[model samples]
Target: MAKNKNGSGFSRRKFLKGVGVGTGALSAGLLSPAETLSHAGGALAFGTPQGPGAVPITLHINGQAHRLSVEPRVTLLDALRMDLEITGAKRVCDRGTCGACSMLLDGKVIYGCSMLAIDAQGHEITTVEGLSHNGRPHPLMTAFVAHDGQQCGFCTPGFIVASKAFLDRTPHPTREQVNHGLGGNLCRCGTYHGIREAVLDVGNPTGKAKTGGQAHGAL
Candidate 1:
């Protein structure tokens, strides 16, 4: 046989043979496409984004510590409602535009839907459910009920939570101040009058001592 110009004497037949062997090795070692995809999505494994996997963290809420494993992408609202079973914060807009998912973070009101659970670590989260104690409603809660601030009640939780933060800062807010402070929360029922009255009642001297009395009776 005549020698090829290249020192290795490579030929089409030899190249084809090498490809066949390499393909055979790959076929023997690799999984099917469906099987590979299934494995990739199976669990907390390699090649997965660390941010999407469940991570252990503590949430300080309502004067208590909650230990849980949650994905970093899980919103504070979802973590509270789904994982912790604290559904007081309603998922209304779920987009921060509506304050239905509002909660107190370190005493500052924030939209729970817009915040990541991982970012809330080490901060005190106060939800609507946390506002009550010993079977007694918070002053704001009492005022809401007394003033009939809620109709459908879907937005009541967020309103009440936001009111707490608002009242904490401006304890005796005027009608205008109350309007501006709680502007974030929206009520479809057009109960602005009642909501404003509810919050104002908490600070009014005439209504302070009578807290929960009229509200409970009315309820």
Candidate 2:
């Protein structure tokens, strides 16, 4: 029953206790939507129009259409590898730097890991596994094997996909052009010699060296 100097009934200890209760109530009112939903035993809706559960999406991959339920936040690479079971696109350096997750979207090379699956709708996605026809290897794939362009083989799929897209545009690229074109991709095995040889062989179809490309790996 301690009293203040002013002889008021409201003691400092009582004021402090009231302040703590008020702060707790204020904090409860300011809970995030997700926290509120969880406390109320409700689910949160994702994407626009706000509905529960994953969004339904359609993907056109390798001349085939597939329907899948995926979260809007899922990346195209994750959708391809986890949902579609297309494991050819490697998930290395997923920040779009290493190019190990490169794939063709609408016939243009794109970083699969950096693209959202929801954003890939209405476009043709081509992975390295799609380059073959009826179990027949692509010409670039054939050349890669012949020239021993891959070692450890993790980055080969992305390199092949990117190379195929480049070759499609520039049928006869110089070694410098090839080096610049494939600059985004990195091979830890130091297979630039073999990869340059493979592309040159495909472009020329005869053994003839044009330019010596600097041996450098993508970061």
Candidate 3:
């Protein structure tokens, strides 16, 4: 009975060893020839060759095509400022909360920092630098200057870009609408009143002109 017990134990150990070998061989065999080659190539490639960097992208900015090579992780703001030298979009906060990096994507307002350069491809992107035409400033830009809407001027570009978008959609927005629309931008110099007046001036330039003319006539 002891001999039988010893024999059973030996058989069990042998069976376990066999199972282990069989599993390893089965796993190796399960991988197809193409898969094995690919795995080997991947390892060797990583060891010997450097991976490709910075994919090529074509961006339609302000009615012009700009060809650029940029990394996948680069934001639209970085690509625009660093690569393309278009620095109108400020890099304040570097987060989507502040509208400092605001720009027009397909005629719609979007934060440049929040959007990936790859995603901006194949779309028309309008930056603050591009808002002007024929060396003339945009109406919103002109109004901002006329109304003294900016202070330190760091946040001016973003405000102007956002205002352009707002005016495009609602050309005749009320003072309350301008305030609400521009609430996303923060002014450190307490220039909210001027900004609001600038937006209002864009919508009601005739009124401003008439008032100015009457003031001059009275004087």
Candidate 4:
């Protein structure tokens, strides 16, 4: 028989008993938060507690550091759209599934809706709005427009951002490769074909060169 080995986890019997005790105490108003913390023992770490209120946090976004006071539960998408007024990332699914709220964190693609605003501090966040140089569009952006890669435009920003990450990883990709690379982002308008084409156009210079480098802007 195996014993509870540090953070490995609790045995089924121990877990059920603990849950039963805690739930009953919580329901009967007998378990105080301080008491609960006190019972947790020193080594069974729960990490540093945050808050049930707003906290000051700095988010480095698009070469700028935006300081704001937001609740610990506030998502990065909410911070960008609500607090910071940088609303390039759409709030469609609000979950990580649809990828409408995708943004580039530290030059890598991530779903903004799933990440806490507080956790994004000290990291470079690039939104769709940042993908322009002196108001000039990135080549991938141009190619997207030229290929009619967007229709509803809700998923376009996420697709473009994800495409930028994809191109960075696979700068010279085939049509099938682009299709596979950008599988994370989805479009309700069924514009996958055009989106793939745009990525290919940006990758292939044999066709008219759209703009600049793969790393240009957010692309």
Candidate 4's C-alpha runs over 4 A off are 1-48, 208-219
Model 1 bad stretches (over 4 Å)? 1-49, 207-219
TM-score of each: 0.71, 0.73, 0.70, 0.72
Question: 2 or 4, which is superior by lDDT?
Answer: 2
Q: What's the number of clashes in each of the models?
A: 0, 0, 0, 0
Clashing pairs in 4: none
Worst 10 residues of 4 by lDDT: 22-31
Tens digits of per-residue lDDT, candidate 1, 1-219, equal: 123578677755446546764222222113345543443323333364454656555677888866665678889998787666677898988899889999999999999999988778768999988899987989888778888999999999999999999888887666667778999999988999899888877856465423442322110
How close to the true structure is residue 111 of candidate 3, measured as C-alpha lDDT? 92
lDDT per residue for candidate 4 within 1-219, as digits (tens), equals: 124667575665446546664232221123345543443323322387766666556677999866566678889998787666677898998879888898999999999999998788768999988988899998889988999999988899999899999988988676666767888788999998788779878877665333432323223
Which ranking of candidates, highest TM-score first? Answer: 2, 4, 1, 3
Q: What is the C-alpha RMSD of each candidate to the true structure, in Å?
A: 21.2, 19.1, 22.8, 15.8
Q: Which sections of candidate 2 miss by over 4 Å?
A: 1-53, 209-219
Please give the lDDT score at residue 196 for candidate 1: 82
Model 1 is weakest, by summed lDDT over 10 consecutive residues, at 22-31
Q: Assess candidate 3 and give its TM-score to the true structure.
A: 0.70
